[model samples]
Target: MEDHTAGHNKEKRYECDVCGKAWQQPYLLKIHRRVHTGERPYVCSICDKSFMRTQELKKHRRLHSGEKPYGCSTCGKRFARLSGLWVHRPVHSSERPYTCSDCGKGFKLSTDLKVHRRLHTGERPYTCSDCGKGFTRSTSLLEHRHTHTGERPYTCSQCGEGYIRAKSLRAHQRTHTGERPFICAKCGKSYTRSTSLREHQCTHTGECPYTCAQCGKGFTRSTRLLSHQRVHTGDRPVPSTVCGGGLAMASHVLSHQRVHTSGQPYDCPYCGEAFDSSRELRQHRRAHAGEQMLPLQQTFQEHAGAAGAPADTHQRVTL
Candidate 1:
């Protein structure tokens, strides 16, 4: 009754000197002080992972047990925790109460809006202790630490392949299932990933959003744009292991290594011809289709002359 009266009266008697955060109960204050002290009392027996709270340790155990007790009332989607289900509930509705002042982007939760605002402000509160890399979120910082520790917790049951992230494991599982969930609305082409679908849609719309500042060459993807920029700068970050030759892209290094070994691993389905690289195999396939093939360097040279050309006018290069 006294605890209820303290909460009802908004009287936080127990206060933390470290962060000046007050709690109604002494036990609640003790739990809150763990954040500042970096103390984790609860430990998972399965993974030997430690948590500050017993409830958090109980939730972490669900990952090993695969126990999803919380179910969404709308879509019947199951979650390990009630907070996950609460976060997902907004997805069924169009309502986004939280709005960003900088970008005018709407989010379902105020916490999401706060995170989105960090992008505009260039505020990265979380920092890695090893490499000193900064991230906008604590989760990203935690993931970055895996690189130093080489800890891949997520694993595939079929292939025994391990991944640092759960999302990467889920995407890899799609290859075995042959699940192309994302579909192109115009051409009806399907892809395993949503980003692949968005890149494919750019081909239909002729949208080359990523443009080169030097030659004004537009590319459908930022990766392609970065590769093209390397051509102008003569910046070959990837080095060939065999000859110690610098290559613009990592794929080029693989192709270069095959030259030393005289290896032709990529075989053509149409013809019995083999190529050292997948790019060569793809270009060779176009020959069977009777499609006019333009040399990659020639295409780049031609586009380089036409500076500030319209995005629609830029030829799409599949690299």
Candidate 2:
């Protein structure tokens, strides 16, 4: 009798010397070696996220550029990739041809049913190296690794603010653009992000899920609870990038770092005035539009003094 398992192993065309892993293709073997070599040649120009393959990098670039080349003929709604358009096609029709044996859930796409089966089988193919958190999707695992590495690839070109997720960068960019896309159905007020709209919606519902143990104070958002606890514990976790140990919120930290970096990247299109951050630029615009505004951050004034004067002097002398 012939040993079939050994024969299958012998059939593998390419093998890695370091790990002794065999692959059917030479290109696959070359890509597998990158895991050991720590070589990521394909870099995203929009952010700094690196990829092992050229195709993976190309797919990622569409997220930043918002390019949906694949369009559906039935509805004309577009997607970044062909696979997305294929997945979307089932939604228009009543036909759900693929059925999951485990839970009897019918899906239009075979891929969707395959993913749903993983939930029943408890098979998570994607995993994190740091904490070993398993996710079904590779994209979710890629986003999860950023928390462990502190690798914020997506950055705001407006204020040099770094963000771990592209979606966060998009939301932050809206602030610079003065875009209020997320509108409240109840109050008719608009917000830059959906999270802000959700938090505001909770106010109307009177949903106080987050409760403080110290004073029994209830809050809508966990961040509001953390801020309230700061008054009691005096634990300001967010550290300042400008001066050491001058802890504040993440928003305030970026606003403060402008003085250190001398970054007045936000340029007014109306009057060509430059400001340190988007908030500052917004206030400056309001002045130009003849609107009443409040005082600017005190840190902006403190910069006019010695600690900040050098950066201003340098920019003035250079520009």
Candidate 3:
């Protein structure tokens, strides 16, 4: 009987009837059967989180220990789990495997694709308990937590600026380091972030794909058009640049440029001195003395006289 048992010891095979899954080990087969039975024996003492498999519970306990074994080769970022490091691998490769069904937008991971799909469905599950601000993912909520807690763990070594997220800190450090990794293919202009470079590329392409239904005004990006259409409804402030003498748009700057070149064509003929701009002429007509222009250069004289030396001390010393 001992010789027969020793021969048959390695020949054991077990299969689950419910799932029709086969396992070589009886212990593995018993574990597999729990999936069908929905029985979770392993439970976390701290959080009351239950796991059907003991292996999953063992992996989850690493979060409590704060053990991040898997590290990214490109950024040297450590992740709590192997799956997190697996998801982060494409960032270094710049790979977008997941594509959006609604807008055909691509993402590096399926989790990002899931967030993009929420825009089509308008689903924002993660919400702020205090202000009721909704977000698609919990990571956004974690970042938003900094707004309340003021807890910025990530700090830049160069500028000494703190950020809630490591990505934001990395981007901020580029400002001090003068590092622009994302380069434009057409203009050769570089940006610290890829999103900024992508938005800049639209200017070279002349692709104003986002159009307004009311004014028919086109915008290269959705955010730009959203801010622009708000002008009609007075929902937001009129955006302006200081370089254009306080003009709202580039087209407005072009018109202002023509006014400057034409020596203020709509100016008052009473004034003998012609103005370069219409706004300048309008302010001149008001007789309100314009604000004092700030001096561009700081004037400094030689400090040889103040150093207990005469103005002609060099000639006296030579004689």
* Candidate achieving the largest lDDT: 1
Prediction-by-prediction clash tally: 0, 0, 0
lDDT of 3 at 13: 63
Candidate order by decreasing TM-score:
1, 3, 2
Better of 1 and 2 by lDDT: 1
- Against the true structure, candidate 2 reaches a TM-score of 0.42
Clashes of 3: 0
- In terms of lDDT, model 2 sits at 0.68
Model 3 C-alpha lDDT per residue in residues 80-118, reported as the tens digit of each score: 888889978898876688899888889988888997788
Q: State the lDDT of candidate 2 residue by residue for 1-319, as single tens digits.
A: 3587676666786899999998887989999999999999999998999999999899999999999999999989999988889889888999999998975769988887887788778888999897676777788788767755657899899899798779989998998999998898998999998878887887899767787776666666555666555544544454433334333233344444554555565543222345766777666646432332222223332333444343342232111
lDDT of 1: 0.69
Measured against the true structure, the TM-scores of the candidates, in listed sequence, are 0.60, 0.42, 0.47
Higher-lDDT candidate of 2 and 3: 2
* Candidate 2 Cα deviation (angstroms), residue 107: 18
Worst 10 residues of 2 by lDDT: 310-319
**Order by lDDT, highest first:** 1, 2, 3
Scored against the true structure, residue 205 in model 2 reaches a CA lDDT of 92
